[model samples]
Target: MKIDWVIVGAGFAGATLAERIATHLDKKVLVVEKRDHIGGNAYDEYDESGILVHRYGPHIFHTNLKHVWDYLSRFTRWRPYYHRVLAVVDGKKVPVPFNLNSLYALFPPGQAARLEEALIDEYGFGARVPILKLRESEKKDLRFLADYIYEKIFYGYTLKQWGLKPEELDPSVTGRVPVYISRDDRYFQDKYQAIPEHGYNQLFRRMLAHPNINVLLNTDYREIENEVKFSRMVYTGPIDAFFDYVYGKLPYRSLRFEFATLDREWFQDVGTVNYPNEFDFTRITEFKHLTGQEYSGTSIMREYPYADGDPYYPIPCPENEALYKQYRLLAEKESNITFVGRLAQYRYYNMDQVVDVALKTAEEILRGI
Candidate 1:
């Protein structure tokens, strides 16, 4: 079909851009998604037991940007959700980020008190210190505390998630693991934190429901690229694949999810539990905690990081990033194509971040049109 713009991959990136272009600019846009559904990895649906579950994994929408939050609010109502995660460290489940409350949970009262005082004195109250930065402390007690957290929490999880040790990976990856001096156990401290009321699929449907937008599911763009007539293209798939891997395929980490339905109402104390030093899988997420759904039967998903399967996470290492830069240079030379999203950019981005970039890209494309 003839169209003004052809969007590849109908996830948040492509869907958001298509909505903006169709609604604002009143342009005819065709969105081709390889998957049967939209929303990409953020896709969620009801299972056989009638409980809503994230098909890919848990996606808690949290953003400090008011515009991004407000933009998405146009399509879906908000379900206020503050995500809490616990890690199994030393046979006890404690709050993640190795917070002060966790300090007391893992150590004796006297020892925890001393360590807390030292942390407060050094970093001040409520300060979030990166685990790597905390490890560089000159103080013996602080160093020991960092070491304890590294071994018990960060080390094994990184190994299983990325197939690399904490130190072996990029600093940006390891730096995400921090030590919170406050008792706040919430995984994110954003100003706006909530999930879409109906689920991400519903939100995507509303966003792409404009008359000027046409959606074709289970259709690979590559198969129809030569036949489809379009003025410009927005690609959200892997950047390396778009260029036929001229610089070789960019390394990506995938996930294998195992879902279980139990006869109980709830499964865990928190939304997610990390098994850093315990199991082959990184974590287990209960759908009830995430969806806030009350049902007799509950569902939980176990995420196992794998090297095969569809690309889920871009490997954040120096070598992989450098290889992506080479492909990026080729992408920049393509005047008619705009590459946006996590896979296209080869960066780890949150859902809101992806939306923000897509909106910006759409604005730029509209100006040129």
Candidate 2:
């Protein structure tokens, strides 16, 4: 069969590129996914208890990019959602990013008030400061507050999540959850933050609904590359795997998720509760709070980070990035093949960021075509 493009992986990168190519460029594209389903890690479905649960984990869609928001708006309607996360530190659950409100939540009012003034004085009232950067403060009170946040809030979590200390991993990893001086308890202050109205699965279906696009699920692209005729290839799988691990495998941290259904209306006060110091699992995510599903029973997932599993997080460090650069060099050598997405790029990317990269990749292809 004649195909204009053969896209590997039915995730955001492949699916978005395929949609753009098929709809805008009117090109015949075939999407090959190794998994039995579409939507990749963002895939969500109803459990036996009839509650919508993210099969991989809770993926809260939040982005500051207006173009990314407007592009995704084409396929699915959105349910306005602002994600909030509470971290268990010293037996008290406080807002993560350890904001000004989080200070009041954990400390005595007098001490908290003093620290707040010091924080605002040092870094302004609305500033978001990285815990490590805050730790560099020369002031005694500020230094104590920074150390308290690091030891209590960040250190243990980073150790468990990446199997590395706060200092070892790339600053970007720790920078993700910054200490906000503002009263904003919301995890992300992004301009657009919402989940698909139906689900991510439905969104993928709508995206790949075009006549020019076809999806082959549970099939590796290598199994049928010879069976079809395609001009160019868009690979969204692991970049190292694409070149058959020529330089060696790049390190990654993976998560093992355990889901449970409770008879109660809710499990946690918020959508997610993070255990920074207490448990083997990092956090527990309640699906009902995220999806806004009114069910008598609630479904929650416990995330356990491990060495072996489906690659979830690209381990951010100088060594890993150096290894990834080798594969990136090889990818650049190939003219007809385009590599995109988190795994392919070996970078930590949010859902909208992945979509934005896919759109750009598609645009590049269209310009050449």
Candidate 3:
């Protein structure tokens, strides 16, 4: 069998490129996926209780890029949503980002007021100050506030999620762990925040529903690469695995999710609650809040980070980046292959970013053709 393009994986990266190539370029493209289904980690479906749940933990779509949002808007209608996360600190559930409201939630009125004034004076009202950067403050009050947030909110959570302290990871990651100076409890401050109207699965199905695109699920690309003829390849799987771990393997942190269907209508006040200082799991996400599905019962997922599992998060450290750089240099030499997405690039990316990358990759492919 012959095809214009052979794309590996049926996730956003692969699906977007396949759709673009098939629709714009009018070329036959085959998408081979190891999983039986599509949408990659963003896949969602109604649980046994009829509540929509993300198969791979909670994925809240929030992005500042208008082009990314506009592109996806073509496939599925949007459900306006703003994601909020709370953490168990001193037996109280406060906002996860440790914002001004979180400060008031944990501290006494007078002390909270004092600290709030100090924080705003130091970093302004809406400024986001990284915990590590805040820790560098010469002011005693700001220093104390930074230490408090780091210990209560970030320390245990980071330890559980990444198996390393905030300081041990790359500064790019640690720098993202910020303490918002505002009273906003929303996790992301992006310009647009929403979920697909039906679900991520529906969005993916519509995205890959072009006449020139063919999805072959439950099959690895390598098994049929020899039998099929294609001019170019677009790979969205792990970069290390594609190269067969020639330069050893890049480290990754995996997750174990435990989903429970409760008899109650709602589990928590918000979409997600983090058990930072206690429990083996990092957080519990209530799916109803995310999907806006009105149901009799609630379905929640508990995420536990571990070493041995499917690669979920690429560990952000100098050694891992160095290893990925070596693989990237090798990938750059392959002129016919276009590598995109989280696993292929070995970098953490938001859902919108993945789509943006695939769109740009498709444009590059079309330009060359």
Candidate 3 wrong stretches, greater than 4 Å: none
User: How well is each residue in 82-168 modelled by candidate 2, as lDDT tens digits?
Assistant: 999999988889998799999899889999999999999999989989988999999999999999999998988999999999999
lDDT (10s digit) by residue, model 1, range 65-113? 9989999999999899999999998789999978999999999999999
Q: Which window of ten consecutive residues has the lowest lDDT sum in model 2?
A: 360-369
Candidate 1, residue 27: CA error in Å?
Answer: 1.1
Residue pairs of candidate 2 with colliding backbone atoms: none
RMSD of each: 0.9, 0.9, 0.9
lDDT of 3 at 214: 92
Count of clashes, each model: 0, 0, 0
Across residues 1-369, which tens digit of lDDT does each residue of candidate 3 receive?
999999999988999999999999999999999998999999999888888899998988989989999999999999999999999999999986888998889999999999999988888999998899999999998889888888888889999999999999998777765889998889999999999999999999999999899999999999997899999999999999999999998998999999999999988999999998899999999999998888888999999999888898888898899999999999999999989999999988889889999989888887988
Which stretches of model 2 miss by more than 4 angstroms? none
Candidate 2 contains a number of clashing pairs equal to 0
The C-alpha lDDT values of all candidates are 0.92, 0.92, 0.91
